[model samples]
Target: MASILITGGAGFIGTNFVRHWRRAHPNDEILVLDALTYAGNAANLDGLDQVRLVVGDIGDTELVRQILRNHDISTVVHFAAESHVDRSISGPAAFIETNVVGTHSLLMAAKAEWLDRGSGRPHRFHHVSTDEVYGSLGPDDPAFSETTTYSPNSPYSASKAGSDHLVRAYHHTYGLDTTISNCSNNYGPYQYPEKLIPLFLLNCLRGIALPIYGDGMNVRDWLHVDDHCQGIEKVIANGRSGEVYNIGGGQELTNIAVIDAICTALDRAFVDTPSLAQRFPAAPAANGQPSASLKSYVTDRQGHDRRYAINASKISNELGYAPRRDFAAGFAETLAWYLENGDWWSALLDKAQR
Candidate 1:
């Protein structure tokens, strides 16, 4: 019967975690704080039990303090951030504001309420972060371990690095109970259409050109959202305070290979489910052509990391963490979700256009 606070609960990963937490701990009371930004959709958390959504910013320290004190929140899962790399490149200021300053503010509220104000109550603050903070990995380089040095390459990663540092400082400086997880790329349902998997899936449906940056050979470790959520759950439940964990799916695939996989999946779907061909008539599969025909090469991004992989041995050995969803089945389920829930994403896209 713990009271928990989840920031950015309306966003992709946060939403999944909130639902996951509810199912695992049905008696816990949950409060969600979100800014209702373009990346966040309140409707995502609609109809969930024992959950309250409060539209607000994490940067509002006093507001956060009140939420903490009034609700008697014993745990906070911080997931609010401006996380898109391309968006960060074009506008670094927002990244710094939300990721760095906003995180600092949230920590201040927690310290004031849980530490300074003293209530003998147990508390935890878990920070969710990315593996990009370790910079790029060469072809033969070892996967990023928890001991990897900080070498953030992009504005988004740099900002996350800053937040991670602040969380560490709070733990050491004020003895605030805290833990952090640096995870690899996540893809699943309810993800905004800006990321690679969802964006390409939507484009394939509309017959739009699939843009491939550089030669498309850059590699990434793909972690299913469900697996990532489970890892976070393990950390929150059994993690040692002031420690860091790396969560990964152990599935590595090149960008071009992922695109080809998506194309192949769509081709099979169109053939077996004839109605898909009627729904997306423009898709090359509808007319007996390969979806790969729509590939469009483009300029590479600035400071793009060559590769990113995570070493999850620490979490596995310490917390018994292991990814459950294989890429093949996970990807097929993700694609099926997008196809079946057209109304959900369509409304978001329509709003964005307007």
Candidate 2:
């Protein structure tokens, strides 16, 4: 049985991945290492069995080495990073420290334990990354393919780009088995409120003004977190080492369009509950006008990319990977989850205030 170490396993994507992996590989051992940052919630993994959580920093070389040796970890899925673009804009130091330095330290530890020890078995190191590393796209530009040159526009993507290069360097220089998958924007359950989807959902539920960055025309390829997790698993199982793949949901929409969809979903969800009108009187009416009216265009984010699209044909052709979730259906399900799981997210917000 293979033992896997998943870094940042308590964060949004990491949490979903851990849960998915556990369900797929019940007999395999799974260990999670997370720092429990603002975005990392242990509750995401609550009630999960046969999965151990090790709260620590990924940059700690000795700690990582110890975990690898003690757990006999045969696969390392690296997802630990500072991912928010706004946060990275305000403070780039943390981004560099965590995304670049932390990734380097983790790579070093893996090299020492896996390569130096000469483990005869086929070991894998899968690095989860973002498509923002390719910078913005024109109105008619083709989706970003694997061969797209790095043109990171924000501090967050720049740090991730640096880490991606490090992973590639280690593979070519030391023959370390590594694969990287750059994915589009992910939205699903357990996502922090700072992101666009959850934030808009929460704001709309509370009858607060929904803020849209820029002219609300920024385009993003939205990927369901579950589909993204499935793609990662496929890569781990069939991807070639020293290669990069793109994972996308193929659901391209503008910021305003996504917000409108959320509002419409909320309207449908509350149709049966008359008491919800009293709760959020400002919610959109049946005509879908007021909810769209609640939209308040705000100042654009600094260095915000105009568009982001991913060409996932490589993974689809090579590993038979195709996104199965329809955007409308997946998005409606995600909205239902947030509406029903208020207590979970409320607890997180309460902690953040403290």
Candidate 3:
């Protein structure tokens, strides 16, 4: 059986990707290595017997080497990283350690494993990345393409950019078959509450102030987690080695607009909640007023990128990788998932501080 080693499989995108992968490739063996960090939850992978979950850091070179040998892992899909920009600003050292050094360790281990095999048998390494590596874009600069120059602004993005370069170098210098995909902002179930959409959703639910950074006009192309996983599958299955594909939602919205949309969804969903009554407790009110009133602007993050969009033409045209989820439907489904699964993340958020 073809074996794949996936890092960060307990986190948001990682968990969703694992689920997606299992369904698409039922016969493949999946070995998930995750540190179970604050954001990574064992509960996320609770029912998947097909996956072997191991709690460990990707930085543990020897451990990774052992896992590769024991499992006979031939493919790797790396998703491990310090992902939150706010946290990265407060503690950049962790970001560097995990995103850069950890990737290096994993790559070295994989290289050693490949060398030990010493054959032309096909193997692939898939690197999952973000569009933040392209930094901010003006309204008219067009979306970031696969060929866009790297201009990472935040420490998190910079670290990920470093990892991306390392993956490319491994492909060129070490003859490792690797594919990279840089995706736009992802919003869906299992995402940490610290991100924009979930944070606002929770804040609105609890009657807390919804914090918007700066004027909240920064624009981002939002991709659903499922769409991103689909893109990764396409890249892994059909993409040219050492090539980067940009995966975009094809729907762009300002930060303020996104918050407004969530608030609208919440208000419509919770017409009888106490928070809604406190904000707009009137029978004659125009349906959705209170959710919009929860907005509370905060100081913007340092080095916050203004706008990010992706030119996904290459993935679509070349690999026939059309996104199945559009922004409106995907956002609606995401909001529904959060509402239906409050216990999952509420417990996670409570434990994250401890």
Best by TM-score: 1
Expressed as tens digits, the lDDT of each residue in 1-354 for candidate 1 is: 889999999999999999999999999999999999999999999879999999999999999999999999999999999999999999999999999999999999999999998786899999999999999999999999999999999999999999999999999999999999999999998999999998888888888999999999999999999999999999999999999999999999999989999999988989889999888888888889888888999999999999999999999999999999878988998999999999999999999999
Please report the candidate that would top lDDT against the real structure: 1
lDDT of 1: 0.95
Clashes of each: 0, 0, 0
**Full candidate order by TM-score, most accurate first:** 1, 2, 3
Total clashes for model 2: 0
Each prediction's whole-model lDDT (CA): 0.95, 0.92, 0.88
Whole-model lDDT, candidate 3?
Answer: 0.88
- Taking the tens digit of each residue's C-alpha lDDT, what string does model 2 give over 81-187? 99999999999999999999999999999999998887766789999999999999998999999999999999999999999999999999999999999999999
User: How many Å off is the CA of 332 in candidate 2?
Assistant: 0.9
CA lDDT for candidate 2: 0.92
Task: Provide the RMSD of all predictions against the true structure, rounded to 1 decimal.
Answer: 0.8, 1.7, 2.9
lDDT over C-alpha atoms for residue 308 of model 3: 97
Flag the better candidate by lDDT, 2 or 3: 2
Please give, for residues 1-354, the per-residue lDDT of candidate 3 as tens digits: 688999999999999999999999888899999999888888998888589999999999999999988888878999998999999999999999999999999999988887656856688889999999999999899899988899999999999999999999999998988999999999998998989998888777666788889999999999999999999999999999989999988889999999989877776766645453454333112244567787888999899999999999999999898778887899889977886786887797678667
